[model samples]
Structures are given as structure tokens and as C-alpha cells.
Target: MFTSGTRQLLAKSNKLCLKSGSYLKTFSAKFTTCDLYALVEPTEPKVVTENSPGPNSLKIQAEISNFQDIRPMIFSTGIPFSSSFISSLPFCENSFSQISSIPLGYNHHAILDVCSSPEMVLSLANRPSLTLLPPTNWADKLQNIHMKVAPKGLTNVFNTVDGSSANDLAFKAAFIAYKEMRGLPDELSEQELSTSMDNASPGSPDLSILSFRNGFHGRTMSTLSATRTKPIHKVGIPAFKWPAVDFPQLRYPLEKFEKENAAEEKRCLDQVEHIIKTSKTPIAGLIVEPIPSEGGDLHASNQFFQKLRKITKDNGVVMIVDEVQTGVGATGKFWAHEYWELDTPPEIVTFSKKMQAAGFYHQAQLRPKIPMRQFNTWMGDPSRTLIAGAIISEIESQSLVEKTKATGDYLMSHLKPISIRYNKLVQNVRGKGTLVAFDCPTPEYRDMFVSLMRSEGVLIYACGNRSVRFRPALIFSKSHVNVFLPRFESVLNKMYKQLWS
Candidate 1:
């Protein structure tokens, strides 16, 4: 897969390349990648067969192929994906997103209570076109639910169906804001109007959102242009000629390489400034993931992000922080970028995943001045908003964010020593809260370790090319960590001994 030089270069990973970037095109979502958290829990992984996707699972997959694409999870069974109950099979599920977007785990009590409510039943039964038909309490839903955990400084919200749609909504808001800031009229000129009708601009204006190398935003045409993580998601689709710059590949044990990492951040910032200044398609916005999870759980310092805020402010580019993966309490903070302490918050913050509701929150001005400019049929389901509200209530009352911080510290502390003990097998063990990940010596070893752990009854996942990522639910505790760690260590020991030889 690589020249010796290429292998050695990735081993160091000094600068993350954008196009043709080094990404793991993991064959199965169940087997590879990040964020798409697989939430298996409470019980240990159960494995009845020597090989996963054993005969029974393969037969189930074959049935799926009659109507759907089953190549990705060719051996998946619905049982492992259920958040309601532990898999009857030998492996504890990673609690990953299958058909399940379980908040607290599979069928969390709080979530179940909400879903069982008579009010919830009514809401579900009478689903309306939120944009066309009216929900009298819709504004109330946004205020009481989303605003409760709303990213700092954002006041307006536009809801969508999923993370990808959330991002597309954010991109549109940013582009519209960019044009408004340019003092363009809502009513276009004859040329602008006519050209836009034909999908050209001054109407469809040549504007771009600057993304980083290995940043995965979404699968939509426009947002996909801002996505630079892996080619498979974007292949055969015509991408907007948007500019993407390097995402910093800062060294791990960040405190250990302060000077070096700081220099890397500076280099990336310089590239960002250069692209914003020179790209022929005027840069309308800049989108960033707090951790770049799908790419490899890669992280940059708070200082790096703060500097990005300042730069976008100076350049008049709308700064959109894509928190679809890192939002909620997963990163110890309700919003991961909260650690950045930027004097100004990102102009727009998009969220999904754990929120269970999908949308972007923005400052008042980013709201389109014109009607019908930013809209969809069902603006977002109120039922999902109710679920999000319940999730919020649970997280706040439980103090899950603070608890996750403490638990994550405990987890990371334990992992560091293991990373050192099995130094050849793993390295760069890094995390914030329970959102932790570590790199294996190679992709083969990484996959083997993940599979081995599941066999031993501890389900986890792989991300990027060489990192194993942990994205358990907010309920995961030090107690759960205690249960998982010994199992993880056992698998690591066995894998190191057997595979290293």
C-alpha cells in the first residue's frame, strides 16, 4: 500500500495532507471509522463463533442484499445493533450506530419514558410539514430543548433530519450570510436571477467553504466538497471546487511537544490564511470538526482553534464548527470547542449524533433575511426534539459531563501506562473525556486488535488508519471502565504476544 518512504512519513505524520490524504477506507462501518459510535454496553461482548459474521450472520446479510447494499456490513445481524438488550451472541456490542441511535445505551429508561408518553405518541402520529404546516409550540420546543444545551453564543437554529443535513443547512446559512455581508440585495438583478435559474452565478455565486485535510463534514454535494477525509464518500460525485488546507498533525502527549506542536499549528494557520486570501472562489465560510474524528480522532490545541476564530473574524469569513460528532457531553464539555475559550464563538455550530435532533445554531444575523432562502419540508421532527430534550434533562440532572471528565481522566491515565507497556503495539494514546483514541503500529494490527477485543467480550471500534477510538455513551463510568480495561489489556497482551511474533 505504500513505498517505504510513504510508510515512514505517515509514521511521523508531521503534516496532514488534504487531497489523496492517508485515510483508512475501512470496508465496514462496523469495522472501521469514527463518530458513528457503536453503543454496546453493560454486558461484555459475546462471540459464539471463531469468526465474526459467522455462517448465520452471513446468511442474514445475503437476505439484505436482495433489496439493499450489504457490502459494508456483509454479516451484520440486528441483535448486536440493538440498544435495547445485549446481544445474545458471544460479543458485547460497541453500542455503535446501526439502526439504533440509542442515547443512554440501547433503550435508555429516560428515552423510553419519553417515547412512551401520550404526548409523544400524538406528536408522532400527527407529523406535519414543519415548514408549511404549523406546530404552535415549535418555537417553545427550540427554546426549552435545544437552547438548554445550545453552543455558547448561538441563538437561532434550523433543524434537519441528520448530521449531513445539519451541515448542509449550516453551509447554506454561511453562504447567505457571506452574500448579505457583501451588501448584496435579496432581490437579485436580472442577470443574477436568470443565471441562478441555470445554476450559475452571480446568482449561484462562486463561493466556497474552506475545510481542512481529513475533515469529514457530510455526504451532500456541497458539504461533501468541504469533506476531505476519504475518497469513497465523495467518489463519482462532482465536488464544488472548494479549497482545503492542511489540518495540523500535532504530536501526542501534547504537553511533551509544546514547541513542535505550536509550530505545526502556526504552519496550518498560515495555510488557512493563504487559502482564504487567494482562492479564486471567494471563501464564504470555514468549517472545522473539533477533533476531526472520522479522519483519525486527530486533535489540535485550544490555542490553534482560538487563532482560527481570530483569523476568520479578521477575514470576514463565517466560521462554522461542525460538532455533529463531538457535541453533547462526549468531550467532557457539552461542546468540545468550549475548551478553546475563544473571545468570539464560531458563527454557526452544527450538531447531531447524541443530540438525536439535527440542526445548526447560529447568531441572529446568519438567519436568512429573505423567506424561503433556507428551508425544507419538515424542518425537523418535534418528536426528535422531545427526545433531545429528554436527553438534555438526563445529562444535566446526572451531571454526566463532569462525571465523564473524571472518568475519562481515569481511563486515559490507565491507557497511557498500557500504551507504554505495549509500546510497540500502540502509541500516541490521546483523549478528552471519554472521547479517546490510540494508534496501532499498523492498520492490520489495529483491525486485529479490535476483532480480538470483541471476541473477548469488549466491543470497541477503529478510526482513521491506525487508531482505535472509544466513544461510549454518557452513562459509561469508571466502573464500566474497570470492566472494560482488564478485558482490553488481556486482548492487548494476547495480540501483542501472538501477532508481534
Candidate 2:
């Protein structure tokens, strides 16, 4: 099934793998390697076509574009056929795992086992409306799967569709809780009942969720209103006139700029407090991402987050930590907010991505006393919940969280030196665990950097403005890192020569 050129590439790759055979054997046993990895034991990425988005990829994209937008798609991914011509098809050696959603990497045995189970099959075939007709073992699944890693101080779970809907539910719960906190009657007044239908005040009310600028919660109507990253996600859509506060832009080599970074954080916190106290629309909820994943992978000190928790608590606002992108061991801790070491946890913790299932954990007080307040046809997918169970089990059994922390330290140790060497091209190296990123000289440079990484078969992604973020799966080991770094430096070297040499 291989052409002469492909055979030659494979032959060269085989020669390169001899020295790393011991490491490859051990690593492959720990996790299910992808098809591409199975073909080549080392970290080499192969592109058989003359240029990427090969004819097959382009043809598939053209067919897909007939019915949907293909602008965001990078390439078509599928199992290569046994045909001789299939050698031209490309495969990603190490993906960020579908935007960092894949926890254990592709075709993980645990996940596959769960998916192939009778429970998963039954759930998929006979889906449940969990709020109304939940499965008999639903509570067991929740306790085992979701609650197993529930953030500290949160006792209740509200399963929803995804990060957006999770935040949406959290918003509604906050609004309801806000009214309750005000000692309003449980029953809606006749005026409120009538006004809600027309989408006006008193029922729909002049309430809002305050979000930090550049923090992304989700793309649903209410969550999108709070999303302040890119204009494209918000333009042409009507949004709530909600309040936003500045997120601190801390400088790198943190110790070098402690005073300035602290001052910047204080300024942002002061703004947050001011908006909370003085906004015309009562802020019922305040949503934030621990790492601000899509917002350039921005981070604040633990003290900054601890202060945020205290501020929201003092102001009686429901603090929702959007862990959609940073949760499930990506950031060393299962929940990134755990790094904050808060005396009291945030009121609502929203999560998705790696968890397979999506939802928010909250204090019981945040639960609407009335039923159907957060209802949906499929409250949450049971099959996905099953997958989440498998993921949680694997994370615990493998000690992936602790390992990820070590791996992150390893990555940073290499990255910091690289950043200094290529200071002109790479800047602001910051991350928690495997969730790492660095800024390029410009947005154009960042885009080119991503494209270059793709050409090398290391599929990465860009975030913020000029930032290149790495959201590798939890299973990303030191072996993978060893493979990734040489290529990473190669890309940097190429970019450096282009711009600076």
C-alpha cells in the first residue's frame, strides 16, 4: 500500500526508531497509540503528499462545504484504506486531541471498552430525558462518574449538553437564586409571568452575568454575551448589554515583574469590585475561566483567583468557574480552580472538554427549588457519561494528573530556555501543566507558526492574538514530549531565520 517515496520515508523512520525501541515499547503499553504512531515508533510525522490538504483532503472538504462551512476545518481525518493510493493520505502524529477534548488519546482501551458495553449501547439506543425519565442507575453513574472528581465544597451536579449549556444553566440558577436571596416569593407574580413572555423586565428582569474581558465561557446566547475574546464569535449576533472587567495581563518571568504584575492584578480586581457594586443591571453570576484557554492562555496568580472568590462571595454574586477547557487534569489539577486554594469554593463550577460529559457542579442552594427549570430533551448523554466514567478511572489509576504536572515542569524547563534563546520569536512562556503556550512576535507570525507546525505533522492551535497554545491530551508523556520538542525547536528555528536571520 506504499509508494516508493512513502516506502523510503518509512524506511528512514524505521532506522530512526531503533535507539528509542525500549521507550516506545513501554509507552505503547501505557496507552493505546494511534495508527500513525503504530506505523512509526518515533515522533516523526509523515506527509506523503506534495502539499498538505492533499487532493483527497481537499475533495472531502469540497463535498462537506456543499452543506456546511468548512473554513474552520484544517484537514479531513479518517482511517487510511488498504489501497496503494492511500499512502498519500496524511495523519496527525500528535494532535491537541480535537481541541483538547480527548482525555486518554484516540482509541484508548478504557474508553473503547466503555463505549462497547451493553450499558452504553442501551443508553445510545434508548436515550433518556434525565430530568423526567432518568435511568434507574442514573444516580449511581452521577456519583461514580461526575461526583468522583467534583470540586471541593460543591455538593450537587446539574448535567447539561455542553460547556455553553452548562454555563447557561448556571446563569439561570444564579438568577433564580439571586431572586430567592432577595427574599422574593417562590411563586412568580402575575406581572413577572406576563413580562417574561415578551422578553422584558421584572420576569426576564434586568439581570446579567459579569465576565472578564477575554475569558471565554461558551457560544450559547447568554454565554456568548459573556465571551469577549474575538469579534467573529459575537458579531452579527444580539447580546445582552452585560458588564465586563479587565483580566490581568501579567508579564513573564514572573519574579522579574512582581510589583507590576501585582499592581495590574489589583487594578483588574478593583474594576471587578466596582462593576459588581455599581452596575445598573444586577450581576447575578460572575463567570471566569481558570486559565482563560482561548483568551491567549491567560493566567492569574492563585491569590488573584482567591480574591475573586472572596469578592463574589462578599457581593452575593454566584461565582462560576468555567473549567470547560482547563478541567479534567489538563492543568495538573483536575479542576484548575483547585490551584486557587480558596477557603470557600466558587458557587458554580462548569466543566466539559476532557470529561466527555458536560455540566456544572454547584452548592445545593443553587438548585432551583422547582423542577423543569433546567430541562432538556436529553438532559445529558448517558453514553458520554459512560465515557467520562472510563476517563476518570483511567486518570486515577494511571496517576495522570501528577504525571501531567511533572510533564508540564519538564516542558517548561525546556521551553523557558528556548524562549530566552529565541526571545525575539517566542515570548511570554506561561502554563499550568500540559496546558502550555507562548506568544509569537505578531498575530501573523503566530498564524504562520501554527501552519508550519501542521506541515511538520504536529497539529497545534493558536489562541489569544499572537499566542500559540499547546493543549495536549492527558496521556501526553515525556516520550511524546521528547518527540515534540525537537520539532518545536525546528519550527522556532525556521521562523527565527525567516524573521530575524
Candidate 3:
């Protein structure tokens, strides 16, 4: 039930387009707001250019290459607009390409309304140094927004710049807490104070965070050490000697291979416990993604995660579940770790991506005793936090999390049959909620699949060696799934015919 003011606010921005073919038709309607996106989004994707880059995109790439690296640039979108499609020309995208960062779809009316508010203006204009001078409502905002969805058993939030910084700070907090647990004096000793400036141990200790193989945290100095997805991300970068453990590699269909998958998970869990017990450098914290997004969208059973949590607890290693990609509502549960149902929750859970704000939630114990250790300039942007608040509100009001679960189930029902039909091309279909993925026969095929999907105007992307990951926004509904499946099968059919030829 929208209030009069809320109705007025939505009505002001309700004059959106219903794109048909290449033409966008204007319609003015009073929406119930339950399915606000269908009114705002294009009916279907439209690709004007024969090639993905086309002429306009290539020209922009050439211009950008003069001062920036455009090697990573696939194509340029046209005029920015609301809905998943950022542009009105060249093509419209059902975006998952930006690494699942677009939370409530692009330029959603709710977000737009937030942007136009006095609160947003003040946040942008002031941009205060939060550590020294946080807004008066700072505490209230955090409690109302972040705490509203804080993972069960976690009560504190530490805001940072992005996922990488969030993990980095979490690591620091773990280290500080680790030393404090050893009954070290709160105040630094003379030797500890002097050695710190020289970047030596005792102060700048050789402590490390344990991360899994193919797990990616971030690219910051400390986080780069913990990331293990690709050598390309770590090559030539100096890294700490952090121990890397094997994440469970389960076979799919998970039901058919239950016994073997159980054995594999047990093997990995054994290795994790072994490493934590015997690492030469003290493993102060262990970080893991509930689903390793960049690492082929891998998954382990709830039992496996529970055992892993128990291992971390028994071994006295701080458990930091890195939910940078899997957090928010994408994974059915608002926090994916909720699936584990750990007897004692993980000490720290870091987040970014869809949440729109970057930070970690932890038990109060992880807060460093000494001040200025985990400090940063602009500790976090209030504007982004405000946006995050709006995102949460929209997610709650529309029951997007539950909807995502239903959509994911809908998507899987289609993908599983397609995988069987194209067994040579598609394998290992797996996902939770809308964060789904499938593996191609090879890296080349996966890349080709992504390229063709983009040409078909669905901007999907790949991960790991040969997996195509689908990262749809929370508003992705059954109608969107219907649009996606035919295009998906068309590409598969085309690829399969070509393979035989």
C-alpha cells in the first residue's frame, strides 16, 4: 500500500518506455508497484549492431585507448537510462557482465527517487570524512539498513571502499584480535613500536589469512596475497606467504553423484583442518566464499560448510566468510551463509557487490582494541550507504529474495534439460537462486558462448576455465527468464550444428 506521497513520487517517474524491436513506445500507467520493472524495462533485448563492438562502440574504445587500457572493454552502451539496459542504441542488456554489481537493476525509480532526495544531495555535497565527522544519523542509518539484514549472530559492521578493502580490514581485525587473545598488552611496547616502522615482525607481523584455491578476495596489497583464482591477477605483485587450501570440487548432478561428492567434500575438509593445524605462519583468519563466484561458481553442501565451520571453531582460527559476490539476496537467503546454519556463526562476513555498499559484519569481539589500526579516509561513502538502504527497502518491499529463489528454480528447470540435449557442449549445470552457471566443453566454447550471447543482446559473462555464469538482477522475473531461454537455446542450437559441420 503506497502512501499518497510515495504514489506521487513513483508517478513522477512512471512515464517509462516499453521497447518493441528497436522502437521504444511511451506509456503512462499507474502501476501497482509490485511489478514495477516490467513497466520500466524493455520488452526484450535489441541489438542494432551486427558485431558486438559495432562502429560507435569501437570509436569510443579507440578514444578511450588513448589514455586508458581498452583491452577489457567489450562494447560501449549508448545513453544511460533506467532498467537493465543502460542504453537506447546499439543494444539493450540484461546485464550480468558488470560482475553482478547492479542490484535493483539500473536507474530503478526507487533509486532515482533516492537520488533526487535532499538526503542524497547532502551526502554527495558534503562527503564528510566519516571517521572524524560522521553524519548525525550515521548510527541510525546503519542500524536501520545494514543491521536489518545482518547475518544471524553478527552484530557489528565495518564499512570500507569495496570488497577487497572489506576483506583486508577483516584480516586486520582478525590479526589484532588474534594477538589480543594471546594476552598481549593493549599498549604497544617500545620494541614493538620501533619495529613497526621498519615493517618487521612483532608489530608488522608475518601473520596470514588462509584462503581457498580459486577464491578471489580483492586486488589490494594484502588481499592480493589471499586471492588465488588466476596467476594473471597475482603475477608480478608481491604477496604474503599465505597458505592456500583446496576447496571442494563436487561432481554434478549433485544427487546422482552424492556418495562421490561426499567423499570429495570430506577430503577437502580434512585438508583444511590439516593446513590450519600445521601452517608454518600462524593462520589468523580463514576466508571463504559461500559460492566462489570467480572460481567457476563452485558449491559445497550445507553439511560440508557446517563441518568447515566447526573445524575453524575448534582450531581457534577466525572464520571470515567472504560474501562479496554471494551476499544480499541473490543466493535465495539474504546472506548465503544462512544456509550453513552454523551452531556458532562465522566470526566475520564481508560483503559488497549487490549490497551497493562495501563492508564486513562481525561479532563485537573482532573490533580492534587499538584505534586507528583499521582506519581509512572516507571510511565509507554515505551516498553509497544511502543507496544500499534504498536497495534493501526495495528488496524487502517486493520480496525480491523469495522471488529470486523461484526464478532460479525456473531457470534450472530449463538449463538441466538443455544440458542433457547438448551434453557435448554444456556440463555441470549448477547454481543457487539466480546466481546460476554452466560449463562449456572448453574455454574457447565458453568464450564463444559469451560473445554470441552478447551479440544476441544478453550481456552474460564467464568465470573459471569454462563456465558461463548468469548473474541477473534481483528483479529478474519469469517473463525475463522466458525471454532468456529461447535466445540461450538458439545459441546452443547454432553452436551444436556448427560443431557437427
Cα lDDT tens digits, model 3, 1-501, are: 556676445444453332232212232134433345433346688777889788988998999899999988877654343323434321134548257887777657677668767899999999988889999999998899889999888999999989999999999889888865455566778888899999987878778789999898999999999999989999999889999989999898888999999999999998898888888898889999999989889999999999988988887789999999998899888989898888999999999999889999999977877778789889889999999999999999999999999999999999999899989888999989999999998999999888888778888888998998988888888888998888989998888888876
lDDT of each: 0.79, 0.83, 0.83
Error of 2 at 82 (Å): 10
Model 3: residues >4 Å from true position, as ranges?
1-40, 79-92, 95-97, 181-187
**Candidate 2 structure quality by residue, lDDT tens digits, 1-501:** 456577567545544443344323443444343333344333445765666677888898899899999977777765332121122222253447778787876656687567657788898999888878989999999899889899999999988888899999889889989966566667878998999999987878899999999998889998899999999999999999999999999997899999999999999999999999999999999999999979899989999999998999888899999999999998899888888899998889998889988999999887888877777898788898999999999999999999999999999999999999989878999999999999988999989988888877788889999998888888788877887888889998898788777
On TM-score, the leading prediction is 3
TM-score of structure candidate 1: 0.88
Clashing pairs in 3: none
Listed in order, each prediction's TM-score against the native is 0.88, 0.90, 0.91
Worst 10 residues of 2 by lDDT: 81-90
Candidate 1 accuracy as lDDT: 0.79
Candidate 2: give the clashing pairs. none
The list of candidate 2 runs beyond 4 A from truth reads 1-43, 79-95, 183-185
